[model samples]
Target chain A: MIEIHDLHYRVGAAPILSDISLSLPEGSLTALIGPNGAGKSTLLRLMARLEPLQSGRITVEGLDLATTPTDAMARTLAIMGQQNSVASRLRVRELVGFGRWPHHQGRPRAADREAVEAAIDAFGLQPFAGRFLDELSGGQVQRAFLAMTFAQDTAWMLLDEPLNNLDVAHARALMARLAQLVQDTGRSVVAVVHEVNYAAAWADHVVAMKHGRIVAQGAAEAVLTEDLLSDLYDTPVEVSRHDGRPLVLHHHSHSRIADLSRGRLPDRARLS
Target chain B: MRFAAGLGLAALLALMLVSLGVGAAEISVRQARSDAWTMLVLMESRLPRTLAVALAGAALAVSGTLIQSLVRNRFVGPDTTGTSESAALGLLAVTILAPASPIWVKMVAASFAAMAGTALFIVVIRRLPRREVMLVPIAGLVLSGVLGSIVTWIAWQADLLQYVGVWMSGEFSGVTAGRYELLWVAGLAAGLAWVGADRFAILSLGDGVATGLGLSTASVMRFGLVVVAVVSALVVTTVGMVPFLGLVVPNIVARVMGDNLRASLPVVAASGAGLLLACDIIGRLLIAPYEMPVSVILGVLGALIFLVLLYRRPAHA
Candidate 1:
């Protein structure tokens, strides 16, 4: 279990995350979703300890976040952020190999090397393993970074905006991988996702955040409703059943023609 | 990698031998007529000059690699960070305060000042938004400019401008066996840098990544900076100022290699030594007997390469 209680993070005078509390279950695929500026990434970074907790308590698998040794913490959790601008000259395999640093420090054993190879294969990156990161396309680079995170082989994985630069096909492939990771290895996963459909399709749990606070969190069907999403984004949203899963759809509001016939543009059509 | 390193080593040896032969006293079989005289010249000046040039080049280049990694900016090095400038200022102060102080005292003072200068750069960088990535290095260059003016003013006020000029214009003519021994410490610092290469490499990935990997970034950053300070202080005290040695050599090596410090450190050291050796040889030949300092030669060459690197592509933040 990962527990966060009364967590608050501030930058200068502005609060980035406030009064957050949650218990994340083990072996679950948890999706964090929110509109822009909802503090989703900040929340992810805090849980990963990438951002310091200003005031609160967080425990991962009975280890206090405040006092756990970094190396020990690393053995339990691995995180990949959106901005992974490491030197592009590094080979794809070498970049993936860095995931083993926490375990090996500097010296690698046979098991470590094999783990790296397995990760490379898991992402189907074998063909480009020898290629430098700069030579890969944006989506390929994203996959390579994901492979590195997986190579850590931690029980818990935190990813912030991992789907950026990935096309629909790649996104589905990654979601499938994440689902498989949860089901096969029983590793707990929390991912910040922009597209709610991806979350609706694959996530067992959904965490909705807004204005630095958690609005709701539960099973995907319970939290991802038409009323909630419309209010969450300040735009009308429609949710319908698709293969027994919620599929969200919204396009410029259903009142567009009525407003247009009234001799005025729809509210959402304003250029300003 | 082995072949390139071997080739570089071979080139360095060849340069050292040729450099050992270029001076006024022709060290040859003819000079064997007086073995004592030839041996004395070789021991007293020639060998130390070659060794000092090699050590300084290697030290400064490794220092450059560490500084660039420490600041997480490719453009930053001793020249831009005010490290060399502060070192010069410390040397100037000692020269003014104790005109007759021994070389060790001056070195101590310069090391202190250089560390202080780098600390300032770190503080400034800590406050930077980091989104405006180029601004960090530009700020470092600005800091260097400020420190340079202070050094100039102090030199001008004390009527010791010539002494300051000699310190700023690096050369090997004055290096003797005992005078350049501090670089041995600088050399050891470079070796330590290589030994701790992975720490620095991960640090270059940025604090978030390093901390996420469960590494204590603060201590590693401090250690890297200590290496940078020692290298800058020792080299400045021993050889005046060798501009762009840290910036250009490490960059060229990293371009061929990657920025993985473990893999790139020794190569950076070798490339730096080779480049400085080449520059020193050119200085000796450019106006034979008149003998230009390597700094003057490297200034023009380093500037040209730095400009090319700058115009080639946008640097990562």
Candidate 2:
């Protein structure tokens, strides 16, 4: 379990994340959902130790984040942020091989090479392993980065917006892969997802934030109700059941005139 | 791989011999072997100059590769980091303070100052808001230019401008057997960097990734910066400022061979030696009795090549 208490972050004079306290259970897939400027990325960064803790304490599996050695933490948790921007000249395989650096330092043993190859195979990236990152398309590059993170082989994988720049098929594939990893290996996964439907479909737990504070967090079905969805986004939304999951509908307005024209309103709406 | 490296080694040895053989005195290979005095002269004068060129060439190129890899920026180099300029300033200060100071003393002072300057550049970069890598080099270039102007002004005021000019012009004319020993420090530094090449490559992947991989990014960066400063300062003390040698050689090598530091390092070293040796030969032949500074020739060539590279789409970041 990862526990955060009274986590606060400020940049200059403005606060980014404030008084955030939460416990992430192990062996679960959690999705962080929020509006723009909701501090979702900041929270994720803090959890991953990308940013130092300002006022609170974070512990991963009973080990203190601030006091534990970085290598030890690395072995336990892996994080992939939104911005990649890796040197494009590096080949896909070489980039993935870096995941084994903690284990092998500089010299790669047989196990390291085997792990890298398995990661490549797992991501279905064997065909493009030798190719440079620049040569790959956006979605392909995303998969390569994901492969690199997976090759890290940590118990906890914290991904900040991993689905950005992926096409619909690629996005679904990535989600499916994450789901499979959680189910098969019992690995803990936390992803900051922008699309509600993705979280609705795959997330076991959903945490909602607004204005740098957690507003709601629980099981996906509990926190994803119509009232919470409309309040979270400040827009009216209709929730319907599909495949025993919530399908959010927020696209069109439910105007009385449209309803009357469609002959789906009462006599009062038709007369008006 | 061994064969290719061996060929490079052979080419480097041949260039070294050719460089030592041709000079203003025109000592023939046969004549030098026949007389003891001539042999001593050849060994004492030409050999040192050849070694200086080869060592300084390799040092600058290796340092350049380290700096570029550490910052993950192609345009970065020792000169751009203000290291050479700082060394020049340190040498000038020694000349003005103790006009009769030993060359070794001056070199030590310069190395210390150069290291300090590189440390300053790294600290400034670390304090920034973390933008693109290109900004780091640009900032370093501006800092170097500022430091260089200060050194020039001070040299002029001290009336030691002539001494400073000779040292700043990047020439191998002053090299002799005993005086060129300072360059051995550069050679040692290059060796140290080669041994740590893997750590440097890992650090180049950005601090977060390196930290995630259990490497101390700050420690690795400090080591890299020290290597760059030491090699650059020692070379500046021995042969003056050679422009673009560090920047152009590593970049060209990376383009041709790829960014695998283990593979590209030796190539960068060889290419650096070849470039400097060829430039030095041309510098000797163009003026014959009166030698043009190798720095001027290299600066012009390096600038042209750098511009060409800028126009071509970069294959990697």
Candidate 3:
């Protein structure tokens, strides 16, 4: 389990996150969902130690995040941020093979090679293993990065907006893969998901943030309610049951454009 | 890849033979009458000159590769980044301050200056927006120009312009057994770069990914800075400045072998040595008896090749 206590982050006198405390359960998939400027990504970065702790304490699996050696921390958790621009022209196999760096440093043993190949197979990258990363499509490159994080083989995985540029099919496929990994291997995953339905469909736990504070967090069914989500995003929403889970519909039936077309619009101040 | 490396090595060996035979005094090794004279020439001048050329070539290329990795820019090299010019400035300062100082002291002083100059360049470029890739080398070139003018003005004031001029243009005519040993240290720096190739390759991916992968990016970058500074300083103090060997060699090698430095570093080093040796041989043969500096030929060819690189399809695609 990951524990956070009294976390406060600020940038140049502007507070980004304030007085936050949360504990994420082990062996479960958690989704962090929030509107823009809610500090969701900053919170995840802090938990992964990508950002230095300013005033908080975080512990992962009984190891203090502030003092643990980076290599040891790497074995405990793997975080993939939203950097899609790769500078070097590396082959997919070589890029995936770097995930074993913490284990082998520079010399790769046969076991490490086996793990790399296993990761490649897991991601269905055998056909493109020898190709350079720049040669592949956007979705394929996303999968390659995902395969690298998986090849790290840590107890916890953190992904920030993994579905940024992926198509609907690819996004659904990635969510399924993450769910299967959590179920079969009992590894923990925490992802920042924008689409609430994805969280509703797959996340075992959901965390909602607003104004740098945790608005609500609980089991998926308990926290994803019609009133809470509508208030969270400042838009009216309807929640219904689908396959024994909550499905949120937030797209408005009568949009402002429709009001404008029907000659029932208010002043431009309200529209702006 | 192995076949290409083998061919390069073979060609480099042939170039070394040609370099040894094409000096000013014609002493044939096949003639038994001047055997002692031939051996003396080979030992004192020919061998050291050839070896110095190869070592300086490899060191400059590796140094350039390290800088490119640290800066994450393809076009910046030691020549353009104020490294060589700063070293020349240091050499001038030491010459003017203590005319009787030993050569080793001068080399150390030059290395310190080069480190400072390169660090300033990094700090300057770090402020610019990263997506504008062309801004980096342009900044480096401007820094080089500023440092070059300072060195020239100081040299002119101190009545040391002739010495500084020799150091500005690279040549092998004055290289002998005892005078050209500093480049062996530069060669050692290249070997160190090879040993740390994996870290450099990882570093090129950027700070966030490298740290996520558990590398101490700060320490690795510091080590790289020291390597680049020392190599550039040694080359400048020994054989003067060799332009574009660093820039051209690494790009050509990457074009053929991609940017996996561990797989391509050895080839980069060999190709650097091979290209420089070929240039030196051409300079020697072009205007026999009255030699032209290798930098002139390299400058001309490097600019042409650099234009081609700029106009070609983006290598990222």
DockQ of each: 0.47, 0.45, 0.53
TM-score of each: 0.93, 0.91, 0.94
Full-model lDDT for every candidate: 0.85, 0.83, 0.88
Count of backbone collisions in candidate 3: 0
On lDDT, the leading prediction is 3
- DockQ agreement of candidate 1 with the native complex: 0.47
lDDT of 1 by residue, A97-156 (tens): 888999999998999999999999988999999887767787888888888889888989
- Interface RMS for model 2: 2.0
Q: What value does the lDDT take at residue B111 in candidate 3?
A: 94
Candidates' chain B TM-scores in the order shown: 0.94, 0.93, 0.97
lDDT of 2 by residue, B64-143 (tens): 99988877778878888888999998888887788689888888888888988888887777776665657887889988
Stretches > 4 Å off in candidate 3: A252-272, B29-34, B313-317
Name the lDDT value of residue B267 in candidate 2. 83
lDDT measured at residue B63 in model 1 versus the true structure, 0 to 100: 92
Q: List, residue by residue over B219-271, the lDDT tens digit for candidate 1.
A: 99889888888888888888888898888887787777777778889889888
Error of 1 at B212 (Å): 0.8
Write model 3 residue lDDT over A110-189, tens digit each, in one string: 99899999989888899999998878888888788878888888889889888889888989888988888899889999
